[model samples]
Structure formats: C-alpha cells, structure tokens
Target chain A: MNIYEIEHNREIVHPNTRMADVIEADYRILPLLYRIGIELGFGEKSISEVCCESGINPNSFLLICNTYLLTDYSPSSELIGSANPSDLIKYLSSSHSYYLNECIRELEGLIDKVASDLPANQRDLITTFYKVYRKELENHFSYEEDIVFPYVRRVIEHKEENEKFTIGTFEKNHSNVDEKINDLKSIVMKYIHSTGNRFESMQLLSTLYILERDLMKHTFIEDHILIPMINLLEQSHDSQ
Target chain B: MTANNKRVLIITPSRIVAEGLITILTQAGGFTIERVISSISRENENLLHTIPADIIIADPSMFGFNILQTLKNRLSEFTTAPLVSLSTMPMSRTIAANFDEHISMFDTAPEIVKKLRNITIVDTSNSEESQDNNIGELTSREKEILVKVASGHSNKQIADQLNLSVHTVITHRKNITHKTGIKTIAGLTVYALLNNLITTPNENL
Candidate 1:
C-alpha cells in the first residue's frame, strides 16, 4: 500500500490516530518507528499515547508520522527542521541492514536456484551479471550508510558542512543502480528463454521485479525524503 | 540526447501530414523525430521492437478501426510510449480515449508541441501518483493482480502464478478497472509506477 491511498481516503496521519491502527495498515511502518526507538507492544493506543508512554519527543514522533503518512514526495518542514538527526540516522541505518542482509540475500538464493539448471555458458553469464549488479547495489547502499548518514549526523550536530562533499555532489553523482536492475529485468524478460521450467523462471522474474520495486522505494525514502530533509537542516545551520 | 528529449515516431502514409508534423515538432528543437514509419505494417511494427520511442503519432485514416486497434494493442505489449492517433474529423471521446491523447489536423504546430510537452512531463515524472493510488476499494488479492497486470503479465500468466483460473483473473481485472476507472494497460502501468507498484529505470533520476 502506498502513502497516497492512506493520505486521501483514510486519515492515518492525525495526531489522534492510534499507533496500532497505523501499524496494522502497513506493517513496514513498524520497522521505521522501531529504528527511531518507538516500539508499540500490547498497548492499543494513539500516537500521542505511545509517545507519552515511551517518553519519546513529541516533535520527533509527529515528524515521522508525517513522513510515513503524507502522499506527496515532498518532505515536511517539521520533519526536516525539528526531528532529531540521530533518529533519522538510526532509521536509515536499519534500512541498510534490511537491504544487505535480507533483500539481497534472499534474491541471491533465488538466483542460484534458477540459474543452476541452465546451460554452462548461460549460467555463467547470468551469474556474472548478478555478481556485478550485487556489487553495485552494495557499494551504493554502503556509500549512503557510511558516508551520507554520518555527514547528516554531523550537519544535525551543527558541524560545518563538508566544503568539498556537498549534498548536491551526492545527488549529482547518484549511481545508476536502477538502470542496472532495469537491464537485468530486460535481459530476463526479453532475452532469456525458459527451459520448460516456466514456474522457476516466473519465480526468478517475480523476485527480481520485487527486488527492483523495493530498492526503488528504499532509494525514494533516501533521495526524496532523507536527502531533502538533511539539506534543509544544512541550510538552516549555514544561515545561523 | 538526454532521456528527457522527446523521441517521436510518426506513422502516416500521407507525406503531407508526416512532413507537417516533422516541421512543426522539430521547429522548437526539443523533439527528436526518431523515425517516420510511412505506414503501419508488419514490418514497421517489427521496427518498433528495435527503436523504442517516447511518443508515437499515427494517422488512423488508412487502417480505420481494425488496424488501428491492432497497432495500439500490439504497441502496448512492448513499450509505454503514448500512441496518439491523428484524426482528420471530429472523433468521439471514446475513440480518443483509446489512444493516450488525440490531435486533429487543424491543430497548429505550437498547439501540437504543447500537447507533446505536457505528455512528456507526465510520462517522465511521478506526477500522476495521486490518480494511481486512489485504489480505495480493491481487496489485497485484487491489488496483487493489479500489480501483476501493471508488470505486463497476461491474464493467463497471472492466473498461473496465483493458481486461479484465467476467468477468475479476468474478473478481478475487470473489477479493478471498474474501481480505478483506468482501462488501458499503459495508463495502469503509469499509475502502478507512480504508486511504486512496479519499477522503472532511473525514475528518480
């Protein structure tokens, strides 16, 4: 489920909305909140209730709620301006772990299964492609986790913005992770012929497609939401 | 050229119409006339497989309903490029709606270019995220089918994946269409991409 539906038809972002209902709506939101150290366990209560119970800063809670609830891609001022940088840093770090450990690992197993039965040459080609794509994705994610997130933390702490390594540089130099994945999808879709194992091929393709979709969403959170918020913080720091 | 530059394919048997479009579309220099397929035939369709275009403008006078419909259906299989049919006379909204958008012979160069620019922006961006995400009443099962459909899965393929009959898949698709009010696969695909139901190349970039 996308944020657009929740924002328009359902009112999931109101301060009074129960945290339980929000979690029920999209279980993924749980991990995001958990990253920010907000755990909703056994207490069927509103966001305010949970925030109060956990003694979490109310501003940070609202910032996160708005990020998950708003349909548009634009990050809110509250999220960019007020929320603690440590909170976002922790959230993004956990997301990186999920990608490297869970998503990529699962896809690797599926690829091994699917490519095992193919001819030697075809299998070699597929394996090589997968390895290259895997490396690129890992590099991209780590670049964010190691370089970008820490920079964001420093900026949040009012450290001088890196004169050489601005956010615009990262934006401009963003890797073509999506393009390589797209090539993989095209290769499987257009070139690879099923060797009578239609089910296996379907499974492989479905996994690739889902991985691509998930990665894009992850990148969206980083590029569209996270980067902009950090930039806002940087601007405010510079002016001060 | 960058990916944003419009790559247009003109399919008109009439040299007059094709040249007119070429002149007008290239006047401002943003559009790259990728190819001018003289007519829609088996051969031109094959050519489309190789040269992926951004916009396709076809004059439907020669083929009428059957051929035009066939071309539209065939093009939908491979590319998300907008298939715009050029109409000489006033066309019905239903027919116009079949294609992404229609233009008339009377439309001046500036007007035609304006429509092309509008479509280019829509095609390139996730601006249509709201329209796509308004799937208010679809069940999770139906939503799954919609994702599969947007991913270019045929009904039979989707049925096999879900272990349901093809008929069941078709019914779900129809229900999805009824609820979402988006009938064409291209439209649905755009909606899907916007709502992150599917993935595309460097969409954020």
Candidate 2:
C-alpha cells in the first residue's frame, strides 16, 4: 500500500524467482501474469527478465501481481498494462457467478416483496425498471463471458490472428452496471416511501449498496487490470 | 461544518483528554476542532451525523459505550472518514480489523497527524499510485502550488493566492505532474492527501 517503501527496497521484482515459482506460490495470480502476455510455462526465467522483454514497469507490475494477497480491494492503475489477463479472467469469472446467481436473484425477490405493498401502477413501474436493469446486467455478463473472454483466451493461447477485434472493442461495449444500480438505489432510498415495512426498505437499500460496490470493484478489475493487459498484447501483436 | 478546514471529532469521557487533544490540534494549525463530546449519548449521537468530520478519534471504553457499534450503525455516513481508536489497552482485534487505524494515547502529536494524513487519501480513486514519497524533495514554492492544485484551485487562482504569474504556476505544475506522472487534479489531490498538503474534504457526508 505504501509505494515509497515498495520502490526504495530495490526489490521491484524478485530477480531470481522463476515464473513457475511465482505460480506455485499463488495460483490465483496465474491469469494475472498471462494477461501481461507472459507464457505460463515461461522456461524458469525471472520476472525481471520477462518484464524487460515485455517493456513493463517492474514496480507497477509487481504491485498488481501482489494484489491478490490484499484482503480488501483498493483500486490502483499501476497494474493496468502489467496484469496477467488470464489471472483477471479467473477472478472475474467467479465474480460473474456471484452477480448472476446470487445478487440478481436476491434483488428480484426483494423487489417483488416490496412491490406487493405499492399501488398497481407504481408497482408495475418499479418492477419494469428492475427487469430492464436485470436484463442489461445479464447481457453485459454474457458478452464478456461469451465474446470477450473467448477472444482473450485465443490471444493467450497464441492463436491470435490479424483481426479488427481488440480489447478496445470490449471497452467500448462495457456498461457501468453500478450506475444503473445506483439509479435503483435512489428510487428506493428517496422516492419509495416506507409502507410501514422499514425492514424491507432497509434490506433493499443494503442489497443495492453491496451490488453497487461489488460491481464497481468488478468493473475496476476489468478496466484497470484486464483491459490494460489485453491492450499490451494488442500493441505487441501490432508490432509483429 | 467548516467548508475548507478539516474537522476532527474526538469522543472521550475525560475532560482532560479532550482538552489536551484540542490544544495539540489547534497548535498544529489548519485543523478545526469540530467538538469534543464527553459521551456518546443522545445529544452527542446527533452531532456525529450533523458535523461531518475528516477524522474521528474515540476511546471505545471511555464511557463504556461500544463506539464501534455506533459507527457500524451509521456505517455509510462514516465510510469515507478515517476512524481512529485511541486507548491504553491492547486494542480489541475487531477494532484493529474494522477501523481505519488504532493508535495509543501515548503516541506523539506528530505521529497522530501522520496517521491522519495517510488515511485521508481516497483509496477508491484509481490514482493510488504513490509519488514514491518524493514530496520531500519538492521546493517550498512547488509544495504550495501543488497544494493549491490538489485542492481544486485553478492555475489562475493559485497564481493570485501566491502572488505569482500564471506562467510560473504552470511551470511548477508541469514539473510536479512530470515528476509524479499524475496530471489530473484528482491524482494530485491524492498526492496532497498522502503528503498532508491538504486535509480530507469534509463534504463526503
């Protein structure tokens, strides 16, 4: 967390540690290294050598690589180009499961529970908004999982072709799910008067907050870590 | 709430402890002592919500009130501010885990200020990149300009404040941005937060 201490130690990357050793220590970072275009079976070479070969800032690269060890999420742009996309892919996939399976499902039920107490017109409007948002979220996740992730995998697998597709395409399509969720939060917090069921309102607000925060973290990992790594790959491919 | 000045809310039962902190903080300058509440009672509980603080330093056991419970109850309001638990005993593990920090009362005033400065930086901002702690090497003039820039002042405003030409202000900003690789005001704001050039904004509430 302290960047000065990290830089002054003269230990940006462990000079002698092999890629295999790094993966062995924490398999979670495996995709992170891969996103940086480092081959998984990287011939026992040190990270410094790989960073040098790839033209990445070693200090910034290692900071992102070590982020898996942090218990709490803190956003940092330093890891942008140096992240391993596959590592991000792995982390992001699980997050997708949590959102689609748990968060959306739970929110749908809560929205229904709260809507039951409202006027028919008001209930219909609120439910319609929730439905539209849920669909949008589902579609966003599907695009990443189906199209973007497959493209990234092909690049990682070294099957990249001279195609117009790039991470920039994904970035352009990326939706801020958090903003929609915030709209939902404002609707509930400010507009929806409590119908003597304070408990339902509180639960709805709390759920929205968790979804908002979690989605923000998820998008950050994509925008900051995954996309940046993919862009690095695209640049290298261009020079080829 | 003072719009520009950073406020600190100290919750302690002891009058002497509260006054001693008020004196030290006032001498530090630039800090406005929001209030020193003797207990986390109904009257004081209202203050926690009314007066937004950059930092809240409290003794959880001073009045036998669970300060953490009070914080947890209104977690959203206090999310951006750093919460420090000052006590003699080994801080409860939960306090260490939950609060932004834990410091002993015996710690020096400078140490407390340092902790406050560190935690005030908005970690959520993508500008968490450190300047490698290079704020030390900045000239006093550059530091002054950098502080102004970080606090959302325009170059023209900074020039007028420091009695410098806009061109000179721009040059200092370029040097700072080049040295730090942070050209945006938000990034510089975080840099200022780290170096204690400005206090955490009180409008987070």
Candidate 3:
C-alpha cells in the first residue's frame, strides 16, 4: 500500500479542514479506510453495534465519520481539546488525559495480542510488536499533553511568552516520528512478505491477523489526534 | 528436509515468501538450508550478523526499505555468499533504502537463481567487459555502495552509513576503480553520479 506516503504526511494536512474534506480528497483511499473501520470494529453496520463489540463510544464513531468526509476517520480527542482553549484546556488536563491514557492502554494490549500470534516463520514481522510501538507512542503522547498541549492551551487562551519554543519542539518531534514509522514499517514488512519459517508458522499468521487490525486502530488515533493537534498548535501560533 | 538438517539461516519477514524461496533455491541442490527467521531480530538484524547462510532470499516488499538496512548492515561481513531479496517489483526499494550496503535485489525468482548461479559457479572467466552491460553489472550491492560514494560521502562515512567496515569500503572503492579503470574516487563518483546512481546527500542504499 501507499501507507508510506500517508505516514510521511503524518504531521501535514490543513488543520481546519473537516474530516469530510480530507476523505473526499482521498476518495481512492476510502475503501482502505472503510476496511480499517470494519477491521477496528467500526463496520458499516450501526455505530451502536460496533461500539458494543469494540467497546468504543458512539460519539467518537460519529466524530470519526464526520472526519472521514475530509480526513481519514475522526479527529483525535486531543484535537477536540485543542478546538477550543479555555474550558477544553482545564478539562484536557484532567479528563482528556485519562481518556487518552485509556486508549493507549487498550492499544498496547491489542498490539501484544497481535504479536503473540505470529509464526516463528512468516514473511512479515509486525505481529504484536507493542513494546517498541507503545514505548514510542507513550513518550510521544505524553510529551504532547504535558508539554505541547499545555503550551497550546496557554497560547490559545493567554498568549504565553514561551510558546514559540514549545511549538518548535513539537514540530521537531516529527523527525523522530518519521524514524519510528520506519521501524513500524519494518515490522509490518516482516509480516507482509518477509517471514522466514521454522515451526509455528500458522500460529504466527494468526497473531499477525490480530496485530494488523490493532495497528490500523492505533494509526487512526495518531493520525487523527496528532495531525489535528499540530495544526491547532500552528494556528494558535499564527494567531498570536 | 527438517529443521535438524537446516544448515543455512534465512532471515525474512514472511513465511510464505521464505518457503517459496526455499523451494526454488533447493530445486538445484547446490546448497542446503537449515533455518528461516521470519522476524527482525538482533540475530537476524542484518545479513552481516546472521549465522552465515549459503544463500539469503529476502522479501522486502511489505516492509518498505528496512530490509535494505539489514542488508547494508550485512554487506561488509563478507562479499561472497548470495544475499538476494526478490520482490514482485525489481530494483528493490531496499536498494534505494540501504544504498550503501551489499545486497542484490531481483524482480523474479529465476533472476534470483541466475544471480546465485553466477555467484556459486563463478562462470564469468573470459567475459570481463560483459560484466558491466549484463545482469552482473553493478551488482545491486555495488550499485548501492556506488550510489553513496558517488554522492560525495567519505569512506568512513560510507562505512558507518552502510554498516560496512572502513576497510571494506576502501576495498570496494578500490575494486570499483580497478573494474572501471576510473583511477580516483572523484572520477568514480562523477561516473556514478552521471549514471544516475545517487543524488541527495542522505540517500542510504
């Protein structure tokens, strides 16, 4: 797939465009997005059913559907916080952080489930590589919340003096993410067609099936969350 | 045969791909394999570090170019054994990704076998100039290294960049000069650049 290009533009894309606009622009990519939605248990079926099966909130599903019109699926909750400043900032500090933490927790577990399933011999290595992924995602998200998010809220609400430094740091973090994505791509490739079999090849394939699904969900969160947050940060800076 | 008889360790990311290659590789019977590692590990990190394989058949299509890094990290350990990554598409992205390493990429299984045959048989005794024009020309591995050297990278930088030894880089450079009769790194580099081998500064093989 052309996932490399999409991932490369991880921090790119207009901040204010509704998800609908982004998805429409990438109509060809929609089928893949739909498959991911179904894979993530957000099938074309009713949001209620998907939520029940996957245990996700319906509002979030709607939000993702709203986003998929222009973007891939949904704006990250972090983006929701950044959409407004005063109330969202304080709430983000306490509640939104918890929500995000929960998402990360589930994502990590899903990744493990997927990795444990890969065969000792297979073409791809991406089954359940949560350790490397979680470590990076955790660090990245925490940095955004503790450092960048706070700066974003402050700049949007109060025009803090030190925001440029914070924004600069957020932008620079993209390079590291690029490197991480490459690593993930490596793991994915190990799965795609890179496996060298020993004994438990079938077991590995089972693990891969699950892990691949988990990764799709995982990327949805980041692409939806980080991309919008970066845009908000940029806009917040531009306004100041 | 079985795992007990597996002598060569084939590291890849896919079981299907590994099996297909093993089936094809064994069709001729010149070499026998022992194990196939489908994961990316320190043990299978690169061709350079993995237990020496009689032949390595890689599939980097799904992984983008990380397979090339393994190859780049591998090329310097030795230059003789065959490390071939077969892709549905030829001229592997790994070649583009790990431009400084020694790994060959092919589009089809037959091409991969042809390359292995050439390596094992050493059949090019009389056709010296024919090496450059035919499939043997540039060797995906050399092309990778040449792309880097051509782009103004120092031997040390090339070594570190490709995970090859400085001695190996120098040796390759010397060999390239000798084979091409270019006489100098600058000339060799100019020749490489002119040939569209490398462009950007960080274009790793």
Candidate 4:
C-alpha cells in the first residue's frame, strides 16, 4: 500500500511502539527515523528506547512521526509544548539535507535515465523542467536554513526578539514548493510518450509524486508544529 | 553559458546588431546566446528546425514583414519558442504585434534583458496553462458540485441541497476528481479556492 492508504489505516506511533513495527506499518517512516538519527538494530526496542539511545527527545520524535504518518494527527499546543524545539529543528534540518542531497539527486538520476529514451526536444524539456524545480527546492531549503531556523533558534535559546523578522514573515513568504512538483507531474503525464521506456517513465513519475507528498508533509510540520512552537516562544519572550 | 541559462536564438540581418545584443545578453547573465544567423534563407531554414532555443530574437525584415508565416514554414512542428522582435527602426503596430516581445534599438541593456527575461517567464507560464488545459474543463454540473464539495459538504448533504440522489452526487464528485486529478477533499478544496470557485470569508470582504 502507498503511504496515503497506510496513513488511513495505521495507528499513531507512540512511545511504546516498536521501531520495527513502525516501519512495518509504513516503510516511508524509515527515512524520518534516519533523519532524526535513529538507526537499525531495533531488537524489540520501542520508540522511546530507540529515541533515548539516539539522544533524541521521545516526545519530539513521536510528534514528528504522528504528524507525518497520521492524516488526522494535528499537533495541539499541549503536544507542541511537550516537544523540544532543538530536537525538531535538528530533525527538520536533517530533512532538508535528505531532500536536497538524497531525494532530489536521486530524482535527477532517474529523470536522466528516463529522458535518455525520449526524443531530443522532449528530453531537453523534461531535464530543463526538473533542473528548474531542483533550483526552486534549493532556494526554499536555503531560506529555511539561513533565515528562518536561526531566528527560531535565537528565540528559543536566547529569547531574542526582532520585530522586523518573525515567523510571520517566513509564513508569508513560504512559497508552496509542492505545487510546482504537481505542475511537473501534469506536464510529464500530458506530454511524455514513453513507448519504449514505459517502466522508467512510471518510475520517474512515481518518484515525483512521492516527493510531492513528502514535501507536503514537510511543510505541514513547519506550519503546524514548528511555527506554533516558535510562536509560543515569541509570546513568552514578549511577556518577559 | 551555464547549462541552466536560457538558450536564445538571434536571427537578425545586421552583424553589428547581433553582436551588440549578444554583449548585452552576456552582461544580463542568465541567458545563453544559442545561435546568431544574419537572416532566414532557403539554405539556413533547416537550422531553425534543428537548433534548440528557449527564445527567438529575429528582425522582422528577415521574414519580409511576415513573421508568423515564415517561422511556421521554417520551424519544426514541435518548436514553440517565443519569437521576439529586434526592432532597428520604427515599425507599425501590425508588424510588431506578430512577435511575443519587441526590443527597440534605443533600449538599454537592462531594458533588453528585462524584456528577454519577461519572454521566458511568459513562455513558461503559457506552457503551464496549456498543460493545465490538457486536463479538460469541468461541465457546468460538475462545477456546481465542485463548489459545494469544496465548501465541506458531504455527498448526501450535497444531494439533498441540489435535489439529486446521493449516487448522482457521488458520480459528479468522481468526475470532478477524474477531471482535476486531485483525489483528496482537501486538495479539491484548495484547488477550488485557487480557481475562485469558492471564496473564503476574508475574500468576501
């Protein structure tokens, strides 16, 4: 089953949930586990045990996993309060590297392989569109890393307040990176005539779809979890 | 030129004009001059078919005042490069209208670059719109159901409100999903808000 279908039927990962069982529920969570510095050799270890061993806050780990895996899972203020901002940031930043270095690079390779079988103009168009999309993804990640994350970190750690720069500014300027992926998918679906390399084309399209869904979940965590936690920090700093 | 630079094909009769434009484009820094040919002739017509270009800058004199027809005859069936007019002298609106963009001789380097960049943006967006069109438009009934569905109404509720059976409502919803390629209710709602089928309270104000 795909992640969405799994999400519909799967239970939320909790402190007692086995690391192996979580992957069995939805293998997509394996990447999330790796990003948060969790490794294999679960050996019947539960989520909390594995998180403690990795030095990751269990609450933060569970929050990220549930928010990612469960469609109905919304991070309440209480839930957000239970998690550590530093842990969340580490996970998110790791996610950025994972997306840029691994996911996007893999996509480029697959697109090249798929495009090799297409006509010259179509090949150029496909590769060109992918290149543009990759650049956009890079810009999005860099903005988060350079501007947003540092500001959030300062607010959480030093209680620093800057009126000119806030999470609100980031929220306003946070362009939807997934929409362009959707556009690329539609373009490929409509234009590409992969008669000989049908399997490769499907592979490329599926990877694009997975990336789009993964990005949506990534943005969800940012908007729902990260932003609220930072907002609370900003508010507390103001009162102090 | 870097691999990501916009590939621009220059087709002007004056060598001096092409060189000047090329220098300005190089300074502009996101454009690669793909080719520079004096004019389109019988011998060089096939070059247009073979050369990969993101944008085309051609003098109207090269096409004998018939830009669209000449380009159609020369370019391959798949070529969709936005034709830009490199105006050396005063040209009539009718002749200028044939080109996607017009660049005058008196234009500064930045102005020329801006026009070229704008062409690329327009070209990309136009292709996106065409791709969107390939999904096909919803029928009037499908649109009606889509608005209601986006408003967070269930199929039974929609059926009751629209004076139709729930089965019919479900069918319409399926058609909407099939046409738009958006499966989830949330995705459809966002699509509706984007397309302005349903407006939020903030937008109502």
Candidate 5:
C-alpha cells in the first residue's frame, strides 16, 4: 500500500496510546507533533501524559492527530466541540511558521542550487515561477494570520461578532495555495530534464511534493476542524 | 548555446539591417540568429523550407507592392514560425497586419528582446502543451468545464449552463481533478490562469 493511503483497519491514536508508537506508526506525524508543541523525550509517556505535561487538551490533540493521520477520518460535531479553538489556532499558527520560515525558505535554497545547473532561460523561468509561488503562499498565510485568525480569536475571547468578517468569508476566499506548487513540479518535470545536477533537482522535486502534501493537510485542518468549530461558535453567539 | 535559445531566421535585403539585428539579438541574449538571407527568390526558396526556425524576422518592404501575396506563397512552409516585421521605414497598418509582431528601428534592445521572447515563450508553451503526454492534456470539453470551475461555478450550475446533467458535470469534474492532480477550486483557478484557459484572473472570478 502507498504510505499515504488510508487503511481502514489501521489502529487509531488514542489518549492512552504511546507517543513513541504514534511516531513509529508513521514518521510523518513528527511534524504534526512538533507543530502541536509536543517535544521529544516522551520516554514511554502516553499521549495524555504528554498533553498534560505540555498543558495541551488531550482530546483536541487526539482529534487533530486522527484527522491528520487517517484520511477517512472526519471530525464529527462532538469532535469539534471537544477541540479547543485557541489550541487549534496555536497549532495552525505554528504550522504557518513551519511552512513560511522553514519549509519554503529551505525550498528557495534548494531551487536556487538546482537552477545553478540549468541554462540561463530555464534558470530564470524556474526561479521566477518559484518566487511567484512563494509570494502567493505568503499572501495566503498572511490573510489567515492577519484577518481570519484574529477575528476567530476575538469571537472566542470577547464574543464580539464582526458583521463584516466571519469564518464563511474565509471559506469563500480560501484559495488553494498548494496548486501552484503542483504546476511548478509538473513544469520542471516536463521541461527541466537536462540539468547539470540531477541529485539537487530530485531533492527540489521531493521537497515540493512534501510541501504540497503538508499544505493540503494544513488546508484540511482549517476547512474541517477550524471552520466548523468557528461556525458553531458563530451560531451560538447569533442565537444568544 | 543551449537548445532553449530561440532560433531566429532574419530575412532582410539590406546587409546593414541584418547585421544590426544580429548584434542587438546577440547582446539581448536567449536568441541564436540561425541564418540571414538578403532576399528570397526561386533559387533560394528551398533554403527557407530547409532551415528550422522558431521565429522569422523579415522586411516586408523588400517584397514590394505584393507583400501579402509574396509572404503567403513564399513562406507557406513556415506557418508555425511567427513572422515579425522588421520595420526600418513607416509601414501601412494593412501591410503590418500580415506579420505576427512588429519591431521598429527606434525600439531599444530590451524592447526588441521582450517582443521576441513573448512570441517564443507563447509559441513554445503552446507546442509543449500539445506535445507533452505526461501531464495528460485536457480535452476541449474538459477545458470548458475547467473554465467554469475556475470561475467558481458549482457542478449543478455548470450542468445548467452547459446543458448537461449534474451527474455528468460531477464526473467531468472528477476527471479534471484526476488529470490535473489539483483538488481545490482555487488550485484549479490558478491552473486555468497558468494554462491560459482564462485570460485574466478577474475575468470570470
């Protein structure tokens, strides 16, 4: 089976499940764990124990983990109710930092190295394409951070409803920031075959694929977990 | 030196004009002047057909009164290569319309390079889009649906507009997602923009 393929019978991560075992199940969860503020040195601690130590809500942590790990997993209203919006926001903000500061910065460096081995026109094309993608990604994340996140925080904390802005507004404008990366990958694969350093190009492509997958997951969390949770909050506030 | 360098075939009767273009294009970079011919006649007609070129820069004035007929009959084999008018003198609008692009003597090196690059880039990308098999080029019907989807139309709306069943629209959308490897509507919009399915971002959005 493909590593990313959802297995119906695969064990789900529970509060009592060993944190180490979660990583062993799929190493991809390491980034998720890191974004959620769960550090290493769990030392046989259960998920609940780690959450307790980190001052995280165990139920919310499990919801995020199961949602991310299991492709078929959909967060029910109960799951959304159990998740703390502030915790989700913190996790998502950290994920944005990971993508912008760490992931894309690394990609920019790799692409530059790869471009060094290509012809001048191809080099300019690849570099310019990547720069446009990076700008779009930065804009996407900034919209969320500047507009969406702050509004959600205000709604949660002060119960102050902004008639002008809501999660629905976010849902409408939430552009697929990951699609351009897919285009860049295909463009490179199709056109950039005669590069001097094949290894560096391969590294760049692999990093792009990883970033695409991670961005999809991040968007999923925002669409499914974050949106529904905020929608529920909005409905409650409206009824009051 | 690379294959990416666009092959430019200069066809002008004046040696000074041809040499000047060669110097400018060489300085501007990303172009290789493949051949320079002073004039085309029955003896040299075969040379035009034999030489491979991505673009053709020709002086229409050299063809005299019957410029359009001369171009159509003589350069019939080079339908794929964009014929750019290398304007040394003021030309009529009707005569100018025969060529794909125009380059004036007053134009700067960067301006000339920009015009050439625009034509080459669009020409190469169109050819690549058709020839490339790995990306699974979208069919006309699929492209039509992609435009609708990129414009933020729902499956039901697309079905209504295109006079198809909702189920058929859904199936077409699924195939689009599969072929493009893009799931989100925003992603599809960007794809449409990149592929020139939609001319501008705000056109249908």
Candidate 6:
C-alpha cells in the first residue's frame, strides 16, 4: 500500500479538472491529523484515541488503503519540509506509521490470499517486494519518531517543555543523509531485487516499479505536506 | 554499563554499520541489544515476524516482503515478537540478530518506537513459555561459557574467564553450538534463558 494506490482511487466529482485529484484526496488533512496523533502519544492520548480525537476514522478502508500506500517511504525534513520534531511523531504516525500498520495487516492477508495467484517465482518476487517495502517503510517511520522529529521538536520547543525530556537522550535529526539513505538504497537493489537473479528478474522488475511509485509519492507527502506543517508549527510554537 | 544499553535492533551487514550502531544504540537507556539472529532470516517474511521488540516500526524495505518472508517464517509462531531486524546492514547478519527477526526499511528511531508502542498488537495467546528464564540444561563448563558470552566476552575472553586455553573454549563453543544447535553467543544466551539454563539477564534489556 503506497501513495499510488491512494491517488489511483481518487473519485473526483469531475475527472475534467486538474484540481479534482488533490481536492478529492482523502489524505489532504493527514499531515496535521497525524501530527496531533503523534503529540497525543508524547502527552496523554493513546494513538488510537488521538486519531479518533480528530474524527478521521482510522478503520475506514480508504484510510486503510491510504495507510498501506504510505508505508513504503519516509518523512524527511527535506521530504516533509520541516515540522517541529514534536509534530513529526504525529505527522509520521498520522500520515505514515498509522497507514503502514494498516498496510501490514492488509498485505499479510493479501499476500496469503494471492499466494496461489502467482507461480513460486512470481510469488517470491511479490514476497521480496513486500519485504523490501515493509523494511524500508518501518525504518523510515522510526527515523521520524525516534530521531528526526524528536530532534526538531527539541530544537523548536527547547526548555519550554521539560528538562529531562520525554524524548529522552536520543536525537537523530542532526544526522546527515550520507550517514543514512544511500547505503540503504544499495541493499534494496541487492537482496530484495535479488541482484538480478534469474528466478525473479521479470516479476521483480514489476515489483520494483510499484515500490518506486509508492515510495516517491510517500516521499512526496513527507517532503511536501508534512514537513511544511512542521515548519509552521515550529514557528507558531516559537512565537508563543 | 553502556555496553548493556545497546538496545537497538539494526538489520544491516556492514561492519561500518555494526560499529556505527554500537555507537548509537549504546547511548539509549531503555534496554540493551545486539545482533542475536541471522540476516538471511529476514528475507521474504512478515515485517512483524522480524520484530524482536514488544512492537515494530520500519520503512519501505518490504514493498514485497523482500526481506519480510525470511524473518516471518522463523517467528511465524512467535507472539510477543522480540527480534527487531533492520533491512539496511549495508542492514547486516549481526545487526539482524538484534531485531525481532529481520531488517527494518525506515530510517528513524522515534518513528520505530512510536510504531511499536502503538501499532504492533502482540497476540498474547500465541506467545509461549519461551519467556521462562529457568532452563537447567547446561553443564558447569557450559554455564561458564554462557555467562562469558552473555557479558559480551569473546571466546578468547571466555577462555580467560575460566582459566582455560582458547582452544578449550573453542571446543566448548563447538559443543555448545552442537548441543544447543545455537551458533551465535546471543542465541546460546537466549537458549539458556528459555530452558532456564541460566538466570535471566536483568530485565533492563
């Protein structure tokens, strides 16, 4: 479940309008919505309680479908455009982690159901794609919650919050990309892609195509929608 | 003490990464961790199956379970799910062991913690008595090797711990591996724990 699936299901009232898509996006409010959900965890609200607090209906299939799509990529500061680290957890969970869980449950069933649809090779390719997708998806989400967002929030809120810090002593937001993503990309090409194994060459290619599509869009949300909101939140919090 | 706090579950294979993670996770205080499983175990498995934590939080490393199946198949029966395999060791065979079972695809730790804490639902019914830390299967020599390994001592260190030559320790390592069918020191420690072979490490992990 990547961004393509969400965008692909757009049921705009008018197919003739360019604005119909983003406007019809069920995901339009996810950035802010997820931000709140993340904060709820830090403060008092359980995530599910927080998601319901905003009335987004986490159990909905469209939301579930969107959740699945958003699971394959990360929410980068560059990617999401700079949210307070505090808001990042919410932004990520609301916008990403929440969706990923939905995808995991859905994909587990889907893969099991579709196990018979493809040959061993195709199934293997699909399985491979799922593995890469889940791993990258989980890893990226963790960065925001455990590292990136927490760093931003600490920077944004500073001593305005607490001394010991609920975020504890960890801060990964200061890390450089050279330390993180590129090497990850290499592994994706290796084991997940089979490094050009004959058994999954064709099927793996298609799997990669779908993954690339979802990852790009997921990156789009994190890079575009969520990060900007964080920047805005940081500004507002600082001004207060 | 810092060594005991290496609580993260990384899944990459690079020594650069293994060294890198040792630097990072050691600073965290919640629990201690290291690669206790194998990386190939993460391939094509359920993302949940690979999680070695009470929860899971990962990234796109499993668009197709590319690393998902391997981890899941191993822990298909596990319910509390304690392995947290990261997808990027380059995630590694050593770091892979730290995870619940496979490699995580995502890049951050906050997100991982949040996800595991909130989303991953442990099926309590499926969890087993593996948590019992009272197995009594090891002999006195095996106990010595077990303690040394659990304390982060290398085989040579264990040999020194018991005043035995490294060769004797190597023999012990083989016997331990053969008797328990566990290769990594981490695995043997875990085996010791499940069978009550030794007292469990402090819950600080």
lDDT of each: 0.64, 0.63, 0.45, 0.72, 0.75, 0.41
Top candidate (lDDT): 5
Worst 10 residues of 1 chain B by lDDT: B126-135
Residue A61 accuracy (lDDT) in model 4 = 90
Q: State the lDDT at A103 in candidate 4.
A: 90
User: Model 1: per-residue lDDT, tens digit, A1-240?
Assistant: 110112212334656777887777776565467655676574768877777677665555665555455432234555456656566667667767876787778777767777777666556556766676678678887888787777777777777545677776776676435545545565565455657667777877787676665455555566655667777877777787
- TM-score of candidate 3 chain A against the true chain A: 0.39
> What are the candidates' C-alpha RMSDs?
18.4, 19.8, 18.4, 26.2, 25.2, 21.0
Which 10 successive residues of model 4 chain A have the least lDDT summed? Answer: A1-10
> Can you rank all candidates by lDDT, best first?
5, 4, 1, 2, 3, 6
For residue B21, give model 1's deviation from the true position in Å: 23
The ten-residue window of minimal lDDT in model 1 chain A covers A1-10
TM-score of each candidate's B chain against the true B chain: 0.60, 0.53, 0.43, 0.58, 0.59, 0.33
Per-model TM-score (chain A alone):
0.76, 0.67, 0.39, 0.91, 0.93, 0.41
**Tens-digit lDDT track for model 4 on A51-88?**
89999889899878876676545455677898899999
Q: Tens digit of lDDT per residue, candidate 5, span A71-190?
A: 555556776898789999999999999998899889988888888877665565567667767787888889899999999999888567557988989977875677677766765554
For candidate 2, the TM-score is 0.41
> Model 2 - which docking category?
incorrect
Instruction: For each candidate, report its DockQ versus the true two-chain complex.
Output: 0.03, 0.02, 0.03, 0.01, 0.03, 0.01
Lowest lDDT block of 10, candidate 5 chain B: B125-134
Please, what are the lDDT tens digits per residue for candidate 2 over residues B1-205?
3465677877665667777777777777657777665544322342465565778887766533343665544433222456777775775576566667876779899887777667666554432222222334667767888877767788899989887667556657655653454434544554555456776532110
Off by over 4 Å in 5: A1-11, B1-205
Top of the candidates by TM-score? 5
Q: Each prediction's interface RMSD?
A: 19.0, 18.8, 20.7, 25.2, 25.1, 19.1
Q: Least accurate stretch of 10 residues (summed lDDT) in model 6 chain B?
A: B36-45
Best by DockQ: 5
Candidate 2 vs candidate 4: which has greater lDDT? 4
Q: Which ten residues in a row have the lowest lDDT in candidate 4 chain B?
A: B125-134
